[model samples]
Target: MKFKKQIFGFMDMLRFKKLVPNRREALANGPADPLPTEYRTNVLAHRLHPGRMEVELVDAVMVTPTIRKLTFRRTDADAFPFFRAGQYVSLQSPVGDSLVSRPYSIASSPREALENKLVLGVEDAGFFSGYLCRDAKPGDRFVMSEPSGEFHYETLRDKKHIVCIAGGSGITPFVSMAKSMAEGDEPYEMTLFYGARTAQQLAFRDELDALSAKGLKVVYVLSDETCDGCEHGFVSAALMEKYVDIRESSFFLCGPQAMYDFVLKELAPYDLPRKAVRKDAGSCGNREVSDPRTFRLTVHVRDKVCEISAQENETLLTAMERAGIDAPNKCRAGGCGYCHSKWVRGEYVVADGRDGRREADRKFGFIHPCVTYPASDIELIVPVGE
Candidate 1:
């Protein structure tokens, strides 16, 4: 036993000696350079998930009195990325000092994105829309994130037959999908049900007709105007039942908040599975929450706290903009997650259309201040942006 113990001690000493120089060498070498690892990982991530689609405005055309289609082309053709037909692009822009973002559905088909083009239509209202209508000109550069959103048809999840309900400018995504199907870029049968106040407000009428002539089915439901051949009424359960085969087709709804509310009640009788119904990221407006209570907002950024009064009727982003604080936001509707911020301490309420917070964020008490409102005195850790 003693002899074996001596031999073990000698072996242990040799192992210790081997470890000592390697430790010193490692210490001398210091920390490993992270750049190569980071770069390689980033490259792989880009292959898996492309990033930063910067585009330049090539042209703009007024499609209707309240609608304008802006055409953008890739600044670098070599890096242009592809997108699904019904996806959306979140745009970043500087509105005076505050940076705001808005996401518009890619009105152009996926083939267009592959061809380095993206066409989007915006209603001529609000901050970004006003900026585009009044100030945006040709050759202007627009920074957009990669195409995102999951409103497209999935073979495994969605039915081959689609019943699309659109109101106002919500027809954009369906237009893209319909065009793709008509062009044989996608294989699916679609029945589009579009609502408008009048025929004049119906955008892409000629394009829709052309696509319909090429096998896409379209039904226009006009509310205010009466035509001999067209349907004249709101898109209700009776209308849908008469026009759509609800048992075999999946439903897609895109419209204003009011329309959404009305349609939700209209659809209650269908009793379809939750997965069978989908909603577009609609407008962000608090129509039901009247007489909201105002509160104070204290934001901490870079160890500096700034106090601002927040109006109950206005969005947190709007209030911050009014206070002249540069808040980074894209897609004020809360879908893009660009305006993500940590809530240090506060009680706030995110409006309905703007409550797209992820489950992990809800667990972590993070909120998209762009769509959130101060329900009480609150402190937030916000990132300062242009």
Candidate 2:
């Protein structure tokens, strides 16, 4: 028994000797070189997740008096990253001394992405839109983030039939989906209830009419005017029932805040499952300030501290931007949580239906400045810029 144990111990010692050199060799030489195939796949993955891409405005067409469809072409690459039909891109441009960014739904289909082209419909609403409409030219260069949003259809979660309720410029994403369906890319039936104040305010009417040839159904709901071959009323529950069956359909809503409020109330009778409903955060409504006064704001970012004035009505994000503070932000709708900051000491009101912070974040003194309005003197610690 002693001889047998000695023999086993000797074998174990020999095995350890072999492993020691092998481990030494592995440490001396770092990781092995990746194969050419692996290198190519990694490059492709980076292209898909390229944090930001440079694009140039190739064309701009007036879709309506207030809406313009800007076509952007990739300048640095042959192809832009492919996006789901209902995704959005955040475009950044210099307004003056400060850089501003806004989210716009890609009106172009995924097929167009392969050709390095994407479309965005901008409505003349605020400062950014005003700049795009009045000052932007075809040769302008801008940086846009990769597509992001949860407004798209998922086959596992959504029904085969979808009812889209769009208002004003909110019709952009649905247009992309309709175009994708027309091209046999998406496999779902859609009925669009597009609302506008007048016939002239309805954007992409000609394109939508052409898509009807491919079996897409569109019903124009005019609120302020009655027109031939159009529904002259709001996108009420009664109107939806009169046109299609809602019980077996998934509902997708996009538009201004008022439309969202009204539509949500109207749809309450159905009591649809949460998964059956989706909304674009871009259209979340802004709140009016009861006290239209400006207050002082103290912001601490990284090692620098600055003081600025914030209006009671304007969001903290807007105040920071106007004060030339390059605060980090994306989705500006309070959904992405990118501009989340530490609310050191402040009295503020978060807009209803726009607070997307997790319960833990809310409990731990974090706030999304994009949707938070200052009611009194404020101080916050914003995350340092990348």
Determine which window of 10 residues in candidate 1 has minimal summed lDDT: 281-290
Query: In each prediction, how many residue pairs overlap at the backbone (N, C-alpha, C within less than 3 A)?
Result: 1, 0
lDDT of 2 by residue, 1-386 (tens): 99999999999999988998999988789767664665877898978877788999999888899999999998888988888899999888888876777889999999999899899999988888889877899999998888888889899999999999999899999999999988888889999999999999999899899998888999999989999989998999999999788889999999887998999999888998888889888733346757589899999999999999998888898888887887877788889888999999979999887889999999999999999999899999999755
> TM-score of the candidate numbered 2?
0.86
lDDT of every model, 2 decimals: 0.80, 0.89
Superposed by TM-score, candidate 2 places the C-alpha of residue 156 at a distance from the truth, in angstroms, of 1.7
Q: Write the per-residue lDDT of candidate 1 for residues 1-386, one digit (tens) a residue.
A: 99999999999999898898989988889986654645877765674356566689889877878888888987854444566788887776667766666778888887767677788888888887878866888899877877778888888889989988899888899989998888788778999999998888888888898898888888899999998656999989899888778878888888786888888888888788899889887546443557777788887777788898887766777777667676766556787777688898877788864678889999998899878877787878887653
TM-score of each: 0.79, 0.86
Candidate 2 pairs with clashing backbones: none
Where does candidate 1 clash, by residue pair? 101-331
Give stretches of model 1 more than 4 Å off: 1-50, 76-80, 286-296, 301-309, 321-331, 335-338, 352-360, 383-386
Instruction: State the displacement of the C-alpha of residue 147, model 2, in Å, after optimal TM-score superposition.
Output: 1.1
- List the RMSD of every prediction in angstroms: 6.8, 4.8
Highest-scoring model, lDDT: 2
